[model samples]
Target: MHLKLLYCTVLSLIYGLALGSPAISDSSALADLLESSDKFNDHSVVQAFVEELKAISHSSRNISKCDQCVARLAVGKSLALLRPDLVPPVFTQWCTETQYMSNSTCLSTFSRNTVKSSYTGTNFADMLTLMDPFGYDGQLYCCYKESACSKPKTPDVSLSHKWPAKQTKHKVAPVPSANDTFNVLHLSDFHIELDYTIGAEANCSASMCCTPHSKNTFANLTSHSHKDWNSYYDSHYEGNSLVKGSLIDVFKNDSIWSPATTFGHYECDAPEILINSSLDSIANFSSTNNIDFEFAIFTGDAVDHDELSLTSYEVTVNSEEAVFRDIKNKLGDVPVYSVLGNHDTFPYGELGQENHGFSNYFAWNAELMADLWEDYGWLGSDESQYARKHYTGFSVETSMGLKVISLNSNVWYKKNHYAYWNASQPDTFGQLDFLIDELVESESKDQRVWIIAHIPFSADALPLPAKLFAEVIERFSPYTIANIFFGHTHLDQFEILYSGPGGDAKTIENVVASSWISQAVTPWVENNPSWRYYSVDKKTFSIMNAYNYYTKLNETFTNNGSAPVWEFEYSSREGYNVTWPESAPLNATYWHKVASMVNESVEYNQVYENYAKRFSPYVPDCASTDDCALDYCYLTSFTVDQYDSCVENVKNNK
Candidate 1:
């Protein structure tokens, strides 16, 4: 959810990407002094660093994107290596002085240990050691990894394999008058922060707040400014300030902006009690309603979003283990199929593609996830082993003869730096091949397939892979694939994919497929904690309706740790007040109709926006702005190209 914010901050600060912004006067002066020949024993290296900084600043717009990137990478690497001991603290001081990032966030993300660890054992680290400004590795890292330039264009991959001949007209299954349906539980982005503190600063200045280490406010950040470097350095970095003391300690006496509630807060991830409450609610609701779910799909993101300084290998593993265990305990005997989210890993978003040479660096995650799945009886021994080798992706055929293909969609995630290395290829991890194979087999068996993954193939995914995925959907959607499900945006949303790759839908016949982007369980940002379940027609195995449920997060503040009242939010078919034949499945065509309604009717659009974030107070006025039109554009488009074109069309009309 904080993907763009984190990426931009890192690229702008750590990579020295200027982005046409004028350099901060104090930071530039400090850089000049730090790179002076008098301080460094290696004057040549210092001179090289100075020149690179000059090139980055003065010629930022004129230089080739790769050159600009290379210069920034070179300068930053040289500065770090020149005085490994002094660089992190100096950078921390500069970061706080300019208010580029919170002092806690900067120290945690760019500490001496973090910096040193980043430069050790990895291929990227080796590339940095080479110190070749003009090297291909440097250019690749800058151009693709940092995305300093437009990604290289590649030809559209013809449908991975030719699909079966279309039956003159597409055939959709009809819903019977008394549709025999079963429920499907979908929970995503639990994001349980183990160190969550009740009554802590929910309005803290960190990227993620409400944790034990989160600062109370930004008013005290000046205490670590560049002017106080000597004194601050002596007291702060000397003993346990970097490791032992909490960053929250400095602002302990400050009044909290918004005291974190018992259940959760808008600015932070879900606390343990909140996670338990959510699970308890789901269990109680299902039992009370007698809605026996066929199987639950936990679509990734078990770990918390404490990425600034709180994330580590131990935190990730422990958090995931605790969350998964809670799921198993609360929802007994209901097998849960889960996948790894971008935040589920140690470095947050560094999952490596198969055969990418650095794949082993990420093997531990797959292995760990596989072990848990097997122990929890979610997957068979063979299936878990297969997932272990397949980047924690597995396909399991349910007792009902439906093929459930769980994918590790992080291969297409924008935050995973490993994905950008050779991104021009259509399928970086052979996942497309695996998907096609599964779909082909399911089609032959006359079995409907449900594809579940973490990240949606929207703007969050890279263009090439998302395009390939759309093409796959266009090929096999109505015939074999029943639905595609994802969760990452933390909003209750869905997108309709049309017939062509660019998703040009001029007629209802162009509707090919749809993906359900489930709302997150974590109230990260302003979203209320929510979960959803769909009524799937047993005969067609397609979703007939989706029911959303959520609790008022603010209500928990007055309840004194009492369980929040979980209320029925809305249902896809009846809630929106949209018209459709009751006998028809809620497919792409139905969603396309919803988009059309949203585009033309202001009243309906406001209702849609209210339901999106479960009535979060911060929900924007889509009807008053261009967002309703843009939402229409997003819903009607699948591939990135189509999304871009739709956005352009909306802007042009505006």
Candidate 2:
């Protein structure tokens, strides 16, 4: 019989660690040893394989780890090899696995150097299986703060997370009519990787912006990050680098890029330190700023992008739960509505809908949001009752009677693989109809409504037909709709839909269906990681002004002995200077001016640069003038017809 049959575990563990998965090979010495046994094939084949292994063995120490392991496979080991006492399976597995595994530590007698060390002995798979993807779970691997990278951190005492000090007074200026104002925190896309230091290069270009999806090409690390340190310097700081917070800046402040990542499969997500720090940072900011958030809307894509490991249902459930649970811990009593991003669902962009009696997996996923989010004041808790087909669009009315509708816009995502299925569903699975009903209810009661969804409305691949969606929006824009908030584009953008029905009808007399697409908090692409807090009119429910904030990736806590700057970056009404008639801020008239400037060849640059604010200066990389103009037009357009019109305007301008 072949030796491999006798020693499968030893060989499998070594192969999995040294090479990459524990998959069997056809050309390996083990394969030859297994196939060329006297009972299986030519005995000469076994002899040749042993000679080849011996050739490699003599170049190393006498029956070293590799030799001993290989020797066991080729020549066969004594029956003692099977004894767990002589060589425990855990030790054997860990030594090889930890050495080769990307995120691991060698079990130090007194030191905790496993997370970053290339040494072996730790069981990373065991650690990973215990991880809570969102926040601190004892199961995740973390180092002690006092002796970081040297000692492992014991689990935090699981208890009720301490909440922020209660809000006593309002700070910002309220609207003209109302005596009060509501603060809404819009946070999106935090691609938190647990261990990024494993393979992080000195000048990986994705440092400031996004991590390229091609980082998983296996052979070579093909990242969108800057090629060298000099290019990175030139791109971020020019020559005048902000010499503070250096260590904690970039994609991962406290850690390095994970070497163990593959699609859907990951060795880790945000470590407890980093994840808790982020939440603490936000809490501290809000406290120091005297900000009292009435509510918050976290536009989806909570899970990190470019998952190398294939996600399973169990994984999806764990990750999704961890995210919401951690948010609850951090925010405390602050009610925040959430929607599933394309990445939030299993299988990346495929949003599966229910068929016949078959439960749609996406619906199941959305139901998880419903079940977990009920404590956060999600009114659509009764899953079977509130859903419009698989689309989860339900309204939660506040004590003051302000209605907020969370729309499952993934049905309209252009990148969604199941768009065809969404389009074919009856009445768009009552998505649009349900929205109209909500709007109608709000209109009758004069209760203004706000929409929070993942994907924004576009003509192509949307939940409802663009025209129908526009008609419903236009019908309601006059009576009750307040603002529509969305993400997924990963950049700061606005959609200005006509408040009235048709062409050039009344530019000044129009109502702006104000929508804001918040920038992603994840420093994945070149987009500056950010979130926005909008000052909303409590009575009118109109957005008065917007304060956008961003984190500087290059600035770390270690830099210049100061904390990284997470300052208020800009304000919409203040920076744009589109004031008309004194009080109507960012209205249709203002949007029209912006759109005109966008189409205006001479004025487009300033306006475009104004909005496309990155951590550093942004240099446009458009191939030609037409390409630039088309993008400008696309951004200017708010509705489906406007998108088409925006395209026409660009072509005609050409």
Candidate 3:
């Protein structure tokens, strides 16, 4: 799961980008310094890594087996992260010019390599170590995003596997709303591992950085100020003073390592206590918030990161059952629409149409809903119409004439291992095509639409082409698609989508759709585990007010003596200071007010930047505002290209 988290978004700077390696005035000079005198050279290092990449590429020229597909992507991405600057010119040119590259799968479109067929299932230690960006950490290679490497990944397989119905959703009075007003409880990323411990100080840290000390995608984030740099270390790093050791040494000495040894990635994955507390609180909030939420949308990844140990199909079924049953019991009869996350499977993160590589990669959780949710009537008894894409999608019509379509966007996941592809050959399923049809049908009947998924169509989830995703979202136009809700990145952020190309070509007013990149309940990384309450336009369905709720970690774990304090954080309409439209608590008219600040007001932009993380978010304020403006603009219409470009342009300017 830590490895998967590697590709997750950066809410402050740019979200969902495989940020290119930092530029260098003289890469050669730095190479020389690193090789001989500086603090970078090493013994186990492969200086001719680029040559090795070529050899690997040449070897896989005629790869016949499907399992190698995993090895190809795994190894290729490892090489890229190991030395992105060392990316061969020929390879980069081919990737950028000849083929269509997904946000994070540049390695796949370009690399033609195959590892031995031994790295499957639970026996992946050596293979992962081979993929390790050699000589990482102070020798502490905690993780390398989506970390498929050597580390103390929690393999907690011994926990109560049954979901309890100790409490059930109580029937309550619905708060009155305008005839057209639509309210939704937006939830994402429960990451509920049956075995994850609560309040455990994880001294072992994990991150997406190329190096243990560096937190950015690139090892050298020279553009960031020292203060911003420190912030990176503060939020991402997990350890004591730098020490020379293997990734395993930390755990070897772990029984009493440090104050907060991050067991794997960040200190997260919900313990049952937390999950129960969270659900109960959210259920309570909907009843008392004085807002009428029509239904709830959980945008995937309800399962957690214990994939290696989750090798059995029974366990996978159990995990899904636990989460689903819990949500049902807590929400009572509220029809909750859920999506499939990458982690919601057996071998973890597999979403191919056929068996590309994994053994038990059948993603039929949604289909199972026919039985699990029949009483709720969302999926009803017949699953054929709803379970087209591995039971990962379905269109539920609300009484308000709004169509909420949950997509199994996992087919686009970076590590879906080419399930849609033909045995390491290029291929694609008609998932998106299916979505277009759904939307078109909705439009024909004059129905407002909302999309919910675990991953956005961005590199963060290793999604399909950015422009293609933009085209999909933009295809709906002015207001057919009211809003999108997603939750893989676990950051309190917003994505703004412009109907046209995402650049200076579009003016601030030329907007099409906006999304709430909802927060996670796991609190695995930066911010406190949180959820959202959205008040949407009765007519257009755009969010009028978004109230964020968080369990302050420090307070919950320690503050007034470890009694988890679940409290309301702030409202989007209130915190960002968007102008209050007299018609609603917040409205598109006022959303435009917030968007205008991104274009014209620095003060407002700063306020927006500070709250991006919801708890302790930061901006490279001391360094530059170009990226900041771009980040603010992203909330307008989130596009991967614009995000990468904004980051690159900002660094180039620096």
Candidate 4:
């Protein structure tokens, strides 16, 4: 077991003090005080400080939320100014020791450079300007990250007030004929780890493994007993630095607990070899099947989940460039539309909205993506410019009159601490508003729209944006909006947004729009690498069929450097073994029926679970569990409120 340090709790106490009380603003005085005397280390001084913090934490001071956040920012900025090197290490230590976040996650999230250069802004003070005192980020940092304060109440941004009123009678598109269909490839979450080493550790103590030096390979640390190791780490350093060896060190690859192979591992992202092979397979599948794909939509995440300590802006940019180039090279003449994933950013999941005044800091990513997409001929100059201005989110109408709207959904992601500020606002970046504008235009033109993004508008996102998105779907779906696509979950799943009162799958008429979430090319954690392509009705722009293809990861272990073979895993229309009209596209109504089958049929439930993870061995047995029941609810519920209501209703009925 890795040594779990308790000193992080003390740091949390300090953080609580900063949040609750007016923090010391005189940086020069504070720096001099810390440098001249070790007040933070002195027992008498530290105990007094902790007591003061406790009093502040307990006190009901009539301070505004903005003032509180400003004070907290002051403390953090002062500390960073005093010892820039120490600040990041302390934060990383708190994340790892206090939150039990994996070392890679901690490092990636709070690295020294990432701390000073990215996130809300180029510096902490700029971040303070955007924060609301009652912001969700502070609550997350203080209540969850520090465990020093109670979780704050989430501001209610209900859809009842925001949802647009239906104008005319809801007009549903006619069931399409298969004879007028075309193919569109949908690839997502290709977390291509460029530095993947075949024989590296597949099983490690960290959240992500299967890379060179994936674990702390120090013999002194690894060989010691758990008790002795904890004692050693505790006594030697005060959550400051390792005593002898660095966190990463060269080790015998063969000595790993589980050796990685040519394809990939369940615990790791895709290697370059695996990524190339998958792309090759797609080309071959297209050729052999006599299928001509009109275009491809890549829903982001080109970078790997490497340690933030091991990553740099240059590394992130280079990895993405390489991956995009590879895609262009392998899939010749295929115009691939793309979006930026949460992991695609340097610090990971830290993109800020334009109104937040931090977009310029994160604009390099959008700019680069725009350039790449334009260079590949997937986007025109004006479209690329629009994408660059909007953080790589843009709407482009296809030559065939189908409007494709790609969104930088990370603005609403929970992990982008940037989003936590002014949490009550739904369209902070005006991206959702942009979406509505595009949808309205598409509706007027009688052109169907498809929304593509990296993250789903699900519970993993901040509730307000999700609700707003759900409202958008409710108003425009089944008429203007054909479908939405996402890929961050890395699971083969779907989300149905319904309109009207009771948000449930009790009737098909309520089903408005459905998001088709494709499985990932990166296995990451306990999943077979997979991809999907949709057979669409040219006229309706609705999906006629959905095909999933996957490669067995474990088989590559014995192939001895031979490439893994990609094969068809399932089809939405035929694979479920559920009967539906042949003329109908696999729309929201069809999915609603499948959701019912998942609830009532045992075999179908098991099969659904299996296909979700591409038959990974670690697929959970949700067939007889509340998990299976939740799947029904998850498919039916769109926004946070609906999900909560559905879950409560299910439990109450039971």
TM-score of each: 0.79, 0.60, 0.62, 0.80
Candidate maximizing lDDT: 1
- Shift in Å, residue 534, candidate 3: 1.7
Please write out the lDDT profile of model 2 over residues 98-156, one tens digit for every residue. 34233222222111212212322112222222223123221111221112122122222
| Candidate 1 per-residue C-alpha lDDT over 24-105 given as tens digits, one digit per residue, 9 for 90 to 100 | 2234443545546366565444344444355454654666756666655555544544344444444455445545457775
Candidate 4 lDDT over 6-123, as tens digits, reads 2222333454454443322222333344454455553432333223323332345665434443333434433443343444554454446545456765565555344334342233
The best-first sequence of candidates by TM-score reads 4, 1, 3, 2
- The parts of candidate 4 lying over 4 Å away from their true place are 1-126, 135-165, 174-178, 216-254, 501-506, 623-629, 647-654
- TM-score winner, 2 or 3: 3
TM-score computed on alpha carbons, candidate 4: 0.80
- Candidate 3 scores a C-alpha RMSD against the true structure in Å of 16.8
Task: Give the alpha carbon lDDT tens digit for every residue of 376-400 in model 3.
Answer: 6556544435563344566777777
lDDT values, one for every candidate: 0.70, 0.49, 0.50, 0.69
The C-alpha RMSD of each candidate to the native structure, in angstroms, is: 10.5, 18.2, 16.8, 10.3
Stretches > 4 Å off in candidate 2: 1-179, 194-198, 201-278, 307-309, 358-360, 376-390, 421-426, 499-512, 557-563, 601-604, 615-627
